[model samples]
Target: MNKERNQNFKKKKIDAESSYYYALSHEIRRKIIKIIGDNEFTSFTHLKKELNVSTGTIYHHLETLSDLIEQKQNKKYYLKELGTYAYNSLKDNIETIKAPQNEFKSSFLNKMMMITSKRFIMFHKKDRIYTVLISLGIIILGTIFSILNGFTSFFLFFIEFNS
Candidate 1:
């Protein structure tokens, strides 16, 4: 009987340890526990808003963490035995999630896009006129030069034939 009781106690301790390990293994779950530790019994809406994670992701982590954490009567949460263990496990490494402000990187990218768009528009507008003028000039000059050269050659041939 003494041996059986000892075995049962060991099993229960192992189960609790395993649950703590599982909860603390994920970064998101660890962060969740830290948030809950600081403010016990927060709503799901608050977690979703603060963490900036999707509903599905929050729900999954919360479900896994619920086993470790304690829940209040109002479906709020507190630190159960396993939760306290997990919270302490990740206390030092818990990271706070903050939303990034619309900063220089995005503004710079938008400016670059605007500049490129304007340059392309200007090039398209001017390119047609430039191309037509160049083509017409080349055609006119070529025709005039060819006619002059032909007349000179014909006059030289006539003079030689008469001689």
Candidate 2:
């Protein structure tokens, strides 16, 4: 019986730890942790206002974050011990966490704009001018072709009608 009880306690502990990590995985819950950690304590209304989310969203995240945060008799939410640790870790590593995302965004924009690489046709001023001239030349050629084709078709129809 003692062995069984020990096993059950270990299982519960593991489950709780998993739930704690699960709560931390969500962006909204992480924001909640940061907000409460920053203020030391905050009311539900304050969290709602700060997060700019619906009441239901706040409730759902608060429920999920139950293990990390708790409300006092004063009716404000405060971080529990684990929550404080999470807050500190997140605060410390925020730059490291965001660095890759920022880098990806900048690199993606640079690739899309083609402002950095000279291999693309529109990088230099001369290349841009050449591209514009080529584009206009194509448009003019296409317009002229269409006009000639239309006149030929009209002349054919006129001759066939008279015949």
Candidate 3:
């Protein structure tokens, strides 16, 4: 049980880390974070000019990064603590990645993982809690029955040998 709990904790941590990266994997979002991270505050207009994206596109990226950024009273955006950490982490990590020999392999693996995770989540949601309980009950009953049968066989062998 203790081991299972540890595994679950590790799994949760991995899921959260992977989800964070997945959210930030977009080109526009990464640029927005980089721009906001370097400066004290950036207005929507500056981001629009830097990214050369439409106002709506900038707003969408902002919405995606809402957790990391906060709007000031003057309507400029600044990174929260989380945003700063994310920016620095991205900068450090992305700088280390080199062009892979197997670009197709990397993309294929990512797509496969995405599809498998989606299907797994759907199946997990649909699985009933009672099914697990019922399986445990069946295993327990089977074990008890097997032990009783073994005792009966031993008793019969002793009685016949004594006679």
Candidate 4:
């Protein structure tokens, strides 16, 4: 019985991963997954409005993702365990997918991000204090650089106007 259960679980996981890949293949489905995952529980009307799609269109996509999302009480939709797995996977990989392929550094950055994140996670598995600190530091530095760039651009514009 235990062996049977393990086989069942493995089968379910494989089936779920296939469904997830199919569901995420469409742009609308990906958008729907993101919104549903974000809101915890989303209504059909809310999804239609946010996605700017017709009721029929929403329903079509929902049907396509039927294996992933589950309808709840009060006309709300949420991800089941399998759906949650798919959503988490999508969230983890979305950055790589969303990065513009037209840019040369996007691939390099994505690879670097993956490598650094894996190392960071492994090293800080016990505690995330260092991770938080590093993230905060990056945000601060990015903000400072943005402000300086803005000021520099404005200064250059002023100089150009006076000449």
Which one wins on TM-score? 2
User: Candidate 3, which segments miss by more than 4 Å at Cα?
Assistant: 1-19, 98-163
- Residue pairs in clash, model 3: none
Question: What would you estimate as the lDDT of candidate 2?
Answer: 0.82
Q: Could you give candidate 2's per-residue lDDT for residues 1-163 as a string of tens digits?
A: 9999999999988987897789889999999999999999999999988999999999999999988899999999999988888888889789888877776467677676554334345457767876666668866776677566553234234222221
- Superposition error at 65 for model 1 (Å): 1.5
The C-alpha RMSD of each candidate to the native structure, in angstroms, is 18.8, 15.5, 16.0, 19.9
What shift in Å separates residue 96 of candidate 2 from its native position after superposition?
3.5
Runs off by more than 4 Å, candidate 1: 92-163
The order by descending lDDT is 2, 4, 3, 1
- The residue pairs found clashing in candidate 2 are none
Clashes of each: 1, 0, 0, 0
Residue pairs clashing, model 1: 41-77
Candidate 4 lDDT over 134-153, as tens digits, reads: 77897677667756655323
In candidate 1, where is summed lDDT lowest over 10 consecutive residues? 154-163
Superposed Cα deviation of residue 49, candidate 4 (Å): 0.4
Model 1 residue 129 lDDT? 82
lDDT of 3 by residue, 42-119 (tens): 998899899998888888878878767889999999988777888898788766564353443777776875445343
Residue pairs clashing, model 4: none
Residues 1-163, model 1: lDDT tens digits: 9999999999988987787788878988887888887786577777788889899998888788867776677877677767776676666443422223333358776688544535444556657686566557866776667566553234234221221
Scored by CA lDDT, what does every candidate get? 0.70, 0.82, 0.74, 0.80
